[model samples]
Target: MRKIFTLLTIATALLMAQCNQPEQKVDVSPISDATVKKVTAELVKQHGDSQKERIERGVAQVAMLWRITDGTETDFEQFCTTQFVSDDAALEQLFNKLSYGFEMLNGYFILLSKELMKPLHLDWGPVTPIDELFGSYNAAAHLNDDLYANKIAFITALNFPYYTLKEKTEMGENWSRKQWAYARMGDMFTSRVPAQLIQNFSTVNTNADTYISEYNIYMGNLVDDKGQTMFPADMKLISHWGLRDELKSHYANKEDGLAHQQMIYQVMKRIIDQSIPQQVINSNEYKWNPYTNTLTKEGNEVQATPEPNTRYQHVINQFKALKAIDEYTLKMPNYIQRKFEGEFELPVDEVEQLFIDLVSSKEVREAGKLISQRLGRPLQPFDIWYDGFKARSGIPAEKLDGITTKRFRDAKAFEAELPNILTSLGWSKEKAKFIADRVKVEASRGAGHAWGAEMHNDVALLRTRVPASGMNYKGFNIAMHEFGHNVEQTITLHDVDYYIMHGVPNTAFTEALAFVFQKRDLDVLGMKEVNPDKEYLETLDNLWSCYEIMGVSLVDINLWKWLYNNPNATADEVRNATLTIARDIWNKYYADVFGSTDEPILAIYSHMIDNPLYLSAYPIGHLIDFQLEKQFRGRSFAAEVERIYSQGRLIPQLWLKKGVGEPLSVTPILEASAVAVQKLSEKK
Candidate 1:
């Protein structure tokens, strides 16, 4: 078998080289038992090492592939081919191992770095998942600067930076929307953050969730007022999952908990099957050619048909109209454009008119000056929406006095009654204690916080640290969010293959898990029952915010594609392009109902600076949350919740498939949006 393997490898290599020459076919034979055993052993042995070593080795190996000098595509591919020929199996194994091991190590390092910085008393916090996301683009931003300068020749050879931006712009103009969507997704996956470090210190974790709880309570006492919480009463702070009840009741079939699985499956099926088509339709990849009665694209020419009567179609039409306006606005005078920028120093009448033209509600415009005076910004049209969104939706800030005191006191009371809470959620006494023992709480001021997990043998740590924090509804909501993360992490990390598939697929997936848990925070707070009223309100909020942000993601992606396409575009041009995309998206998605026009607030998402392409995750995760929440409605949380989280590190598609018997997709969000719209319309 070993001999046959060698001959087959040689034949395949020879056939590739002989592509222009006469091709000679060779018979291939099966491998022997000894060879198979050796390969299997190698695979098993390669994956068991510490994550740190694996990362260092992988970096060193990739570094060896291309010279720092610029090289052509032919040169780079040739180098890759040569390297592959020498030890293909070894290379493949190393690549797979590094992919899994290093990313988790990245998480571990974040914990270590934070722990190290605290000793020096520097303003060092663990590198958040957010930081990692933004950091992914560091190499690209600095590619022409220091980081990739030394490798420019090599990069240019493969048309690295050149082709990257070129493709984005070219595709933006000509690619089919479906093709563009897939390509953009590929770009996203490839741009995963590189593992860099803050010295050798890194980040570490264990039991800090308890400490955070106490701290939040302490802080809330000092900073917040007595009447209402300063924090927004958003979806992250409320909702309940219904997994366990479905498992127990006859609502779903139960053979080895098949009912719970079916619930998840139904949700997954709804999301994936529906979302793809909608996204494709919304993506402006192809240009309509009326002359040919078709949609003309760069790669393919096709017959055109009327769009379906779908929400996505409306979104597309809105964007197309907005895009036209944006194109014209870019050529407008600076004074006109600056008025649209966050440079509002215009007269009161003008400012008010801009607000009227731009904001969803009049209250938002009134809230703007208050926000601007506090933030020390000259009120701009773009500032009206966000400040107003917060002001209009959030709990008042003055009502939060003594909220922290209540949190600790409440936590203590709740701690004593946690067993009952668990029982209510359908847990046996043994199961309840098993979960409660894993939890540890710390009292302080500010807000409650949770750490993922730290385990020593059978005793795992689930911590809630609310230091100087408040327990107002909003504060309680955040605490609930942290708690959700801790619960999901503890269950998934401990129960899964600890060394390999230890965590969920990406930050977005885990974010979805936390979102699912957050829905139940109100129940934990003993405020509301998990009934349809609460559920309907939460769902409406989700759709409202998600619909808003989807347009924001569109602005971000289009702006990036625009800027990258135009290499010579100045910072001014980039900014203008961004504003254009922002206004276009907002007008298309929201202008009619908001009773507003000519706004660019959506483009100003801080996420654009901190983490590009990340704004989409919020809306996407919210969508997933809605679907999963539906699955868990009226279900037993105690029995099925942990099991769901424990299926860690599976690809998003595979994870959903395993948990819910369907691939990951966007149908869930769209369907939820339609339902939310219908419900909301009825309310009006």
Candidate 2:
């Protein structure tokens, strides 16, 4: 669905004996305040007052990380005095060397990781235990510790130092590209989580990912009360992406659409509350009736067990793993802080408020009413996924599938056409070929994702579920989204001037570009929309999308908050809390619009279980997508994307301002959606 940011690989941990043990605090800095002050004074005297700020920040940073094993106070002082550089030319040379070394180190590590994860991620043979073991091994787990032991980390820290989010925001306006790269280099050694902990996190995260990747529901086996199968006999779908997309697809069917949607909605509820039969998940031996929550085998009802809160257990396991690392972090002591302030570079309160404003807006309610009118029936809770605003909703699923399957028969076929796809989006032939040659498409075992390269010499990967028969329309759409991520990844890494600034501000920005590409899927297929009211419909569609995902994101954010507040909670407790949070969010934001309350459908996103607190990025991405779309109006799409993305890794607001001429806010989408609703209502 979205590109997985691999930087937080250390945040995930295994549910083993080490995870069960009490957290051992790692706050063992031996350098005292006097030592830090003495080092700073000595460096400033040697370097001059012109380098005062750098010297002071550098010394303090090194002092904070120096441990008893690292050396005594004299060693720390000596290290800082000897390593600190005041000359501009020498410093630039040092920065270049460090950047080159880090790029090699990180790039190879990523390559190794991708290779190890192949059996688990790719649609190869069945994954064996050895495959899982290899996947869990973090090749670069000890790299940070190794750097510290060799005093390279100290050297980097002494020169570059660390900048708070506040400092970056306040000073970034006047900062040159080199200054920003220096700031990012400063970010490399902020914390020193143990290598063992890092390895453990990797193992647990891989396990969780494997769990999600294999969680497929045999949709064809699901029967109605009358024992009639609604889906094709071989129709298997992964939870929640596959199931959710299938539900969205049903909106095009006027006759059986409602029944199919209701069935999918029931399945979603069962998944959320953990009431679905254990036998029905990833198995087709039993004929399951989701509506009645019954399973019949050989025309006889058989006993079945509910999933034993396995979903919630994964969440608890992740919480414990991340919580174990809490005491080790310095500036951001907890996962929540690290996620929002450290990673997102945005505050949680601000994100929550953004979602609340959009979901509670008059425009959302008006759009909901319009969706209800278009359906010619009362809106169901599942209507959160209304797809009629897009042109595809009016096209038959079989026709679209036939077109895609013929064009993209397999992964190689899709790979061969990447250049064509890029050219259709307005890139020059040479530029399109350059990008396409650097992107490799492969068949995925799970819902697809884009993995960008860390080195310019490497290629970005686009993975989607390409069936043996052919690539379906859904697969093509997901491939397009991931191709967007690859394009951004390639541009930022290969086009940007600095090695350190080779990515977007956060995963949300990548998701934004993915959304942009996804919206143009039909156009890329040479089936461009000829509707006169296209822009208005798109606005409504964007608004409704934000409305759906914002609530789900709130559930994810609030659930993490709950886990943090109640650290001793069990799996069942977490499950109950999640349901309550989901229901509360649904009642507050979605109930009035859909004529329903206490619906747990918002919690059906798989990200909550595997990727913690990642759901918020989608709604934020939608907002960004809308802004970027506005910027692309009557402009060369490829040129704007390349130029904007090449501005890599600035703080979110500054990046948005530079790209779209306005800071990030919901105002643009809200105002546009309000006008769209009014105009569409007049026509009705």
Candidate 3:
């Protein structure tokens, strides 16, 4: 699946700035409680008693954001008295003006950032240091500062007063589309993080992203204990995504599948423990035996340096940068809170509990046993990525690669066929053309991502690595997934009712749609599932996928918690803690299923290194995808997706409930998987 760069990505970038800086005393509000009371009372008197709640909330919100530099108490009072729009028509007009202005500002800023990062993101050339610097330069870093300086931010905050997640959940059910738009407007300018801090965080984050992007393993150079190469001579796979996908593909290769999986498992362990030789990463100069951690050049053993714990150092740098912004964020004082409550609009405890419940379920063990029986062997640690349930697992990887490479000779070929891809999935030709026209495909420098456009006129960029030889099956599958994101991005932005409400509930929701589109990749290629028990097998696939990712997500969550507790710890300490956490989580949830303990394979996800706290979305997306698949069972797939996502940017549970008529839960998948396991077991 692809990383989604939406409005929240920009928000997070700006919010998580400022590295190693002491907390500045920015909490002292210039607008006093007395002034707030006086302003509220005066506004109520002027606008009438019926507007009391709006007056009070608006005044309080303005006061929360008002600094000494903003103005004096008297000036604050005058501004509120003069600017508070109590008339319904006038307030609506004000909202429209702000919404239009903000869309232009935000959309252009997003465009600028995307353009600046193109050299780093696209398959252009070798990324120079200058390219990295430009990628890290946030054009809108001072957007908040500028808005506040000109009082536009204060005006928006006052009129559309920020609401808590509790408030939204409790009241959003009764809200009109316009009310939801107003609430979204209130979401802007909630923090006053400085531009320098934002730039610093961007630099740190860009560096980490570059590290992960380039950390490819030359698989062809990997040697077994007997000095045998098991892969194609030209094959190189990036960490986690490329490696994991390569491992998953071997499920179709019965000849040497087990040995291949074991070698990849060892490679992952070395990476997690920082024992991977430095010369082997992104270079094929030496033939390295992953099993023995030895590098050999031209039949001679060569001394090699370990990676020096650079992975954990990046983690620590990100932590410190995010921690520096905690003081500026008054309501959600930490990065964790900001990420969950402020961004996801779901609490940390709730998400964690959801993951724990699913991982601990009995369905997982039954599914694992079923997989073991199919494989004719006891489960290995890498079997967490068990791909046997999918129909593709029965098809040879080479065949699929040949089909994809021939069909999509380049990025442009795929781009041109997108409309056909959409129409094959049940969209009308006109509708398909409408969506495909707004999405541009690009060959990626790293594992691809979907970069959504903030403005309606702009196009969403679907980036995936298409080798010079052509687009392979893995790249094609990923392109399909990214196409899902682009379709959603285009729909939510152009078809939604309000500018502020121009996205799904969160990244998880987008991931769900991506999964939906991904499952239909073979269908798009005119291949149908011939298996009589297709639905049951698919259910099992969803279950096993969630089982694997949920454990990884737990590691990401707990690792962040450990970082908070040990802020002063060294990279080596962080590395030790991460391995221990990965092992503990593995023992708790995966050991019984896979019959393996202390497996740090769960920590091998590139997302944990480059995109912090993002792993949870994949599993949650699986749950949502199951529900959406159920919804589309009898209905038109394209129509159902359009209907669901058009109701944009609601809270997750509310969005799920409205779209599929149930809240986000694992029960649907678990119950279905149980039946699937029983039926499949009977078939065998």
Candidate 4:
């Protein structure tokens, strides 16, 4: 907590620095309505100056205000919007000034983190300065960008808690600064895992090229909430391709990238810090602790905490427990699972082969053919799912939607059924009653997905923002998905230690937990009963979904690289690059099924423009969900479900390891799909 506070102090200092310097000669008196007119006139004269000059003058003008803080915001707003200075560029510059200040504050908060652990007794090496670690440079050295570059520079210029204002304002770098650099570096490199990948890191794991494609498809879909394509035919050239060769030099190595990643996570973490449980702090006992850490609170003897590097290992252990279920999913396959109409079973080996065949099936091949002809590019296997998935589960997809709409449209209707849903899953009446009481569902017209926001208090909020258009099958599924998130949210946060951490490890980790429910959602709706045949279909769906997103993520990674490399690329060029990426992924992965010359479906994804570097989670979630499901299969559903969800938020990988007895891996995807395919084939 002390460390976190220190980090926050630095951020505070950055925000404070945004004001006029104390050394400047200026009045401190509050400005009145009359003064606004006078100052507005002077600012108008300065408006014609260069951007820097305008900023300097504004700073000096602000210096004169003695106790002027009261109405300064209003006065400034009035002045800016007055007839005297309405230049768009001028307003933009002002925005830049304000934004720079905001970014500094954002960065400062980001530097603070609860994840820090006690250093290992073993000394490693000399601490590095923050500037050197992150390649800090003076204003002269920083490159100019529309936004990010400026924000980064302003943040770096601020002082840390250990340093006084004078020392912080010093122009030159120092040894202390270097230490900050090293810690920041360490934080970045170690955020998730060293091996944990970025968007375009590799094809074997969650590939970037595939992700980008999927992003585009989702983004495209989001354009028209009414299930209409928002993209124009001619504007399809902005897609991301493998621009790694271009982006590699800029970022250099893992350290640089990790630093940025950590920065984003840290900043967002701070903004939402209030929402996080206090029990997560490095403390022995406190009320409001999450349930998972209660064991520690109940005991007086404190277990020795692991050293920093190894500390993550405990979290990893937890991650394994959560992820152990991935292995079980790998046994289910797609083809045989889909082929079975009702009760059926097949040898696991047969399921695996059938899964492979389904991935390369003729229908999947045809989907590629359709996409390639439409987009004028070769098809990829990843592109198959967004299309094939729709094609395969046509009626079921619609039916699921109908189920959600019927249940969700009337909040009370769903609430009444929730108790049954929970109890049927084996929850005791008391436990079921508790959940039923806390759950609150809301829906609104929106393009983004539903989310469960856990508040600081005992109460939890499960809100879904639906597109303004009427709810559809897709909307229903998304709603159900969010419902799963809310369920995990309630169990983990409400039941955990009030002071201890109570939440999923990361967005992906939570997604994994929510998916467990989503997979079972069909059962909840009685759409896909847990009969042998339905289980087989579910397995097939999982494999297809995972395989498709792997390709989509690939595209997403490449597109970012493209943007990084060709910063000046026209929309058309970006679109062309996207087309090329789609073709490349499709040809390589789907050529066997769809033919070597077919086009890819990446063009249809809606996420490309809306969310960046986010498509990979679907596959990862699938891989994790199946594994977690296996652990609870034979157990008393409610007891095991509560125990698992009760773990709340731990470092994702570490949490799984502890809970599931294994490391995070993709075996679950391979095994489950294979088994489902074999089973479905036998049914036919």
> Model-by-model lDDT, in order?
0.37, 0.88, 0.88, 0.39
Candidate 1 per-residue lDDT, tens place, 1-684, comes to 000000011111111111111222321213233433443344335444332332222222223323334254344334323332114366335434433443343344334433332322211344445543332221111121222234322222221111133344344345443333223222211111112211000111011211111111111111111222222222121000111112112222123323223332332222212221222232345433222224445646545543232222222222222222222122221212222221111222332232223234432223333344433445333222222222112323233324434644545544554455556556688767766566554432222334444222222222232323433444444455555565565666566643234556544556676666556644554544534445544655555445455666567656645644553454445555666777787676456544567565565343443222345455556656766676676776665666666766544544565565554444554455445445534654
TM-score ranking, best first: 3, 2, 1, 4
lDDT for residue 105 in candidate 2, whole number 0-100: 83
lDDT of 4 by residue, 200-254 (tens): 1111111221222222111111112122323222211112211111121112223
Query: Which scores higher on lDDT, 3 or 4?
Result: 3
Best by TM-score: 3
* Per-residue lDDT of candidate 3, residues 280-363 (tens digit): 999999999998999999999999899999999999988998889888887889888888887778898999999999999999
At residue 373, what lDDT does model 3 achieve?
97
lDDT of 4 at 469: 34
TM-scores across all candidates?
0.46, 0.98, 0.99, 0.45
Model 2 over residues 1-684: C-alpha lDDT tens digits?
A: 969665533222111112333556666888889878887888788889999999999888888888888988988878887888888999999999999988888888888999999999997888899999999888888777788999988899889978999999999989999999999888877777777777776777778888889988998898998999989988889999999999999999988989999999999999999999888888889999998899999999999799999999999887777777766675777788788788889988999999999999998998989998999999999899999999999998999999999999999999999999999999999999999999999999999899988887889999999988799999999999999999999999999999888798988999999999999999999999999889999999999999999999999999999998999898889999999999999999889998878899999999998888888889999999999999999999999999999999999999999999998899999999988988888999
Worst 10 residues of 4 by lDDT: 189-198
Q: After aligning candidate 3 to the native by TM-score, how far in Å is the CA of 96 from where it should be?
A: 1.0
Off by over 4 Å in 4: 1-383, 386-408, 415-417, 458-474, 498-500, 527-530, 596-598
